[model samples]
Target: MSAMLHPISRRLFLSGAAALGGVVMLHPFAARASANQAHLRLMETTDLHVHVFPYDYYADRPNDTMGLARTAAIIDGIRAEAGNSMLIDNGDFLQGNPMGDYIAYQRGMKDGDMHPIISAMNTLGYECSTLGNHEFNYGLDFMFKVLAGANFPFVCANLTKGSLAANARDDALFIKPYVILDKTITDGAGQDHPIRVGLIGFVPPQIMNWDARHLTGKAMTRDIVKAAEAWVPQMREEGADIVIALSHSGVGPAQYEENLENASLHLAGVDGIDAIVTGHSHLDFPGPKFEGMEGVDNAKGTIGGKPAVMGGFWGSHLGLIDLMLERDGKNWRVSASTSEARPIFERVDRKAKPLVESKAEVEDAARDMHEATLAYVRTAVGKTAAPLHSYFALVADDPSVQIVSQAQTWYIADMLSETEHKDLPVLSAAAPFKAGGRGGPDYYTDVPAGDIAIKNVADLYLYPNTVQAVLVTGAQVKDWLEMSAGIFNQVEPGKADQTLINTEFPSYNFDVIDGVTYRIDLAQPPKYDPKGNLINEGANRIVALEFDGKPIDPEQKFVVASNNYRAGGGGNFPDIGPDKVIFQAPDTNRDVIVRFIVEQGTINPAADANWSFAPVDGATVLFETGPKAKDFIADVKGVAIEAAGDGADGFAQYRITL
Candidate 1:
């Protein structure tokens, strides 16, 4: 029988040779672990984001918190502990950090070129992988080039080559939707057995909205749950004994919604799937984040009665799933399953310390490429007069986000020259991508006053979202800001020392619309929830909104320049759906910001202070930011910000006089 790697004294590998007393055999699956029951181990690394080495190119320092090389140590240790194992990556492996930018912008993937991330994963001997949304950031040609060099099969059941009308089928996939591997396994009492293990993959359907520029006419996507339901049943008919799903999605509500971003929970409920691997949320499964979630056992890492796991992004964690399978006549049935996430670093004294060092071979795989990437990001592109920082972006008008808004407004004004919306006032909505929420305290942007490099641009704008313009009335504009105001927690009039920031709300969703002035009323409840659902139907948090010196006319029309994500129902803002979208620029927000900085040399960094917190009598709210906020506390407008003390997770506590 055809076989892959042989068992070496009970240690299994992925090569195609078997050795007995140091003598090689034709078939590697000759040894047996048990006669009736065979144990299978699965290791997953998701959202790698091209972190091949133990380094932070943005900070230009060695960071132990993330790296595929660091996670390789844990992978090796876990593989050593198991009898039979297979490694898989759940996607989001293409873009995120400086390394990814370097590959896309500097090193351009040619036909034969090996992507550094793929090169690193190749050395790790990955069995299979799926495409993430970020994979299309560089375009289809580049992704096809990267996939050409991958040793393992790439699968995505949702992404198809044809249009939506074609209906996604196994034959219509851009890549293979699923693969049934005729794996040979050993059972108890030294008996070799054959089993067909099916592996299917699914990415979020939002790729159409996120990377519409690269995927509009050529490709389309189907709903995750719908794709899994159609494909898993076909996999069973194709002689698959055990089926495992590689879901490049996040776990959310159990009730299925069409086009929902997070659909792993519902995908796991599909009948034929034996186990599931989840990602794209940049979170770990079985952690505190999933605690109390419906149909999820955090302790056992099971979702909808199926074993599931989501390894954290940037190689921070290695997801592990163990299955006990028993042979039943001609097929293998999963009897028991367990899952966990193993971190490469542990927090010590509010700092990350490497619990597992980088593996030697993994480091050797991409050392030269890593050094080249660092050099590429360090090249000076422009200069900044004042320091660009986002420590207090949420509390006050920030220069970092202000600069992006300024650039967007400038770009949109030029693009609207001949358009019908040219006469209408153009407002730019910019959000703080790195205000240190789930990203931790060190995640805030801190670019010093000097030459701005490509790394600074990457830090300034984290996402590769494209620039888009949404046309709406003044009333819809106010509703948009009201939705953004949900980032702040409601404070009582007489409440002192109350938390000012809503920790549950992501800083990225807190859009600060430039080209207008407004006040966020903390005394009033938010009109919308963090997910953009209208909760407080009649609640009004935005007060005294003005385009110039006068109150904004509710009936007046305006054009708001923002990213594609916001315009494509990402934040659930009212009247800002795709139908209202008037302008869709192919340029990414990062590129637009970079071009703006280059054009206006030696520009002022001072924020225009368009927004502020309205007065709440007898209220003194306290919030936490990076410790470096102490340097520019006085520059903050409207609010009275005072340094209280050091807060948890290396954040600085600040008191806000409202």
Candidate 2:
């Protein structure tokens, strides 16, 4: 058997392995003592994202890091160890990988058809679930059709069918706001007592902006913390012995704000809310990932002084929250609690050691759909003359990003041919989706030269976001690039191996705009912060910005092709929103790439070196990427990267001199 270190586990040592004896493994609940007290174990699988089988449909290979099948093994083991247990999902299960795309686009769910992911969850006997932002990607009608397959109840307090009323209780909810499970818990004395477990769910209210066209008149969302404040009290009033908030949001910022996307920390502070299961940022809690944040007790797995856990995305971890409940005069109250996100695999010397094997029940439930997904992605659309990889995407203009930009430019130019903006110069913005980051050291686009299939295209462009072209002035374009430059750390002229990439900046936000030329001055401070706020307005990192052959005019208007996420203000970019969008297409960006490849017959997707770093005399910086990157080192343009050494975990180190 081959044991490979997945890119996702490459960073596990820093966040999980070392802290957990080289494995983030946990046994079942083991802390109840008295006859009046009972241990109720809660298991959570968040952001499954249709990864039911132990397979990566994009790579068309087995992956140990993700899959509900593997997670079920942990669930069964945990359930056996605890006297009382319940399993619920924290949303983001409907769609993610190629299997989801196959079901939604090709298989077409009928009224009674069982979605593969739902089938697996049903096999595992999931008690309840909630919604994530991606649930609305295929439209409301399609989402409902797929939801019909779920055997468990779905709850969401914030998502509503229409406009809000004066009071949240009067609003027309899209689904049941909450569900109370009436179960019996066995105490240490073997006494059986009735218990009511209340579970309420919340999705990011920003879904209104991300999926606006699909939800305009039919659906709306309320603020997350605000909704929880209104509903937790109601749940307690309805005789909920314990209240759990299934928040499909991230843990961030302790303070409350209206429509804050990552509000789980504040949501935990709501009175009557006993525990929480968080997701949406695809990160783990109770690990080093959430450590340093205020009001977050990472060592104790508590946020807002209440037990909480965030299972890593794509079925990588199982969130466990064990509450020690004591009978309070015929009712139950949580006395003590502990939480942790136990990973399915751990990293040791750059190799993966799977903690749990795939349970056959879940694998069997999703087997048929998995095979169909394989067939769907195997069909070739076109051929590529050169290999497409994203190993150095964060440090250079990459072909993987270039191909996407080319395809978007082609699609948007044709769309504008018959419009009033036909004369405007069309520019396309794209970023590397599969660049090695949190996904792991093995996570990079590596499509060999030759036939380009649906899988390859999917690898290059991961999201199902629709294409949108925004009309912005040249000055705004400069600002966009300046924002992208924020991903790099400032390098001093005489520095040696100073880290080049900012570990916190996501690769998807590092937009490289095609149809323009620019020089990034690394010596200058970044103009925009990671969240796209202009912190240093006078910092001019983007220098010699040009379009066509002349210096770009601040007043000149141009059509910039991008995805709905950017046009809809998903990334918080300054001066980039729906108001600047001149064209929005129903077609997805992935489909656009397929069509463009088909039209070209054999596409050559080599980087053109349109962008480069402005030399800061003798400055050198280092970064870590996939080990496979060494094979394509000679192909990267403009930057001369040499092997520095092996980095921590499984990543390879490379240095670039300016």
Candidate 3:
């Protein structure tokens, strides 16, 4: 005993001190490890839409706000703090921005060549992914080629192989309805438990209407909620401990009688679904507690105490859901849960900065592909004499849309070169692509006079749509404008106050056709359907139409230039279909816009006095704005700004009248 006590000599004491120092340094990590055993972290990137490398292909510049690279950085930091974690994408992984176009059309995704989106996703080791509506934009054959490059399982319950059974066998890109992954999680006792986590994916059925030509006879899509009900129970019967529904469909009210498109809340109420990851509306569900009615279990924030989350779109936010489970014998039941939305970038002094450091491996994987993507899109496609800006498109006459219409008309004009209708007067309808919406205030396109790069062309025509010319009557042309006027809400006469328009109506659908003159009677209701069918009895928004300063002849056939979607009975306008189509241009609207700019050397495609809102003299209306708009208000005519209200950080409000 005396020797043992004397063992605390200088040499031994120094060694003991060194050992204690090492333990202290490692204590924080040890405690963290113990705490993490009780919790599991899940990271989700939804609606990435081809932003893989943190660069805005439309802007042709590095954007810190978006991209899978920035999101990968955040995922790394989240994993470092959690005991166990998994990464997943919520779909809409394709068909947005110029990089997606660059890979799909320019570089071309072959069977072996790795697509940019697939390459970037592979770098992060995405455990699972779902299908989005945009995936069908390029048609089945092209989609198959691109999806073949992905290493992860492509899951979707609604889409099925139809009549293409033989083709499905030839291409292994066919996906299963659902997949059950056996994931092991360490419990509080430090025991590994094999948990069967079932994942089911759903895409909206509206693809049939939007991309019908691409999917015709090749594939079939079922309704989202119905598809979930059919497969979720099967997944549970497969010995799944927890079931997750990856719904590329969006969250709306459970009220279906009022609206058929509302599916999220209803999907949540479905049995066997433990949690849901939603997307497609491009909105963020910040917490498990959705915008449910009062007196509900706000704390749990679940449909039936089950968790749900919707990450924001375009890699803007990563959805995080933490579930706490209690063990009843060997079975696990979710006891408590919490959800949060973490953005990839945070604004500091009005500038976006990456919130975390990117994983070196992920960056290395996407670096070369990202650079090549940039170089490919940056190639000069054409030139423009005047600056292209969308400032006046929504509110008044705009040059931005005028240029697009000019391009469409010019392109269609050439395609009908050999047709008997070659000399027929041509009018082109185009909309503002950069109108403020999900892209935020900075979404507006403002290209100065000079070289119109390929990036600018993509920005001008965001979709990969080909040009088409419809044979429409003068009366039909008037109805077409009336359909576009649906973007505005009819103001009641003599009303003291009213909102100018229904903000829910997207601005991009508000078509402004060149080669015509008309006025939107705000008092009149819309006469056409979203698919371009005439429904209303006497909706006369376009009171008069003129060509070359002469009143349009209702019997005279005129070629109206529009995109393939609209000419193919999209937007539901009456008599604007393939039967009414006289010519279909080989060039896409994007390519035509580029060529138009190149030919002009400098173009003044400024919006002429084609249309305007009927004057509401002596009446005033309040218009909202961001601080950046204060300077631009002076440009608006006959409108007065009383004062600016305290709006959100990026938004400002103003009072104006017709």
Taking all chains together, each candidate's TM-score versus the true structure is 0.72, 0.71, 0.63
- The digit string of per-residue lDDT tens for model 2 on 112-155 reads 88888888999877889999988987889988988888888999
Of the two candidates 2 and 3, the one with more favorable TM-score, higher being better, is 2
Over the stretch 1-658, how does candidate 1's per-residue lDDT look in tens digits?
A: 5343224334332211121123333212213335778777789999988898988776578989899988887766655555467899999898877777677877788899988888899988898998887888889998999899998999888888876544455447788889888777766565777878789998888777667668878888899888888888889999999998999888876787897778888888889999999998778987998889998999888998899998898899999887888888898898887788878888999999887767767788888888898787688767888788998899899999988998999988887875677799999998999988778878888888888886688788888688999999999999999989998889999879888888888888889999889999999999888888889998989999998899999999999999988998787777779898888764578878876877887656778788999999999988888888888887787778888888998888999888
lDDT of 3 by residue, 555-600 (tens): 8778889988889787666667777866654345876676576677
Question: Which one wins on lDDT?
Answer: 2
Best by TM-score: 1
Candidate 2 Cα misplacement greater than 4 A, ranges: 1-31, 381-399, 407-451, 458-513, 518-544, 553-658
Stretches off by above 4 angstroms in model 1 are 4-34, 164-171, 385-398, 407-450, 457-513, 518-544, 553-606, 609-658
How well does candidate 2 score on lDDT at residue 379?
A: 77
Each model's lDDT: 0.83, 0.85, 0.68
- Residue 253: error of model 3 in Å? 3.2
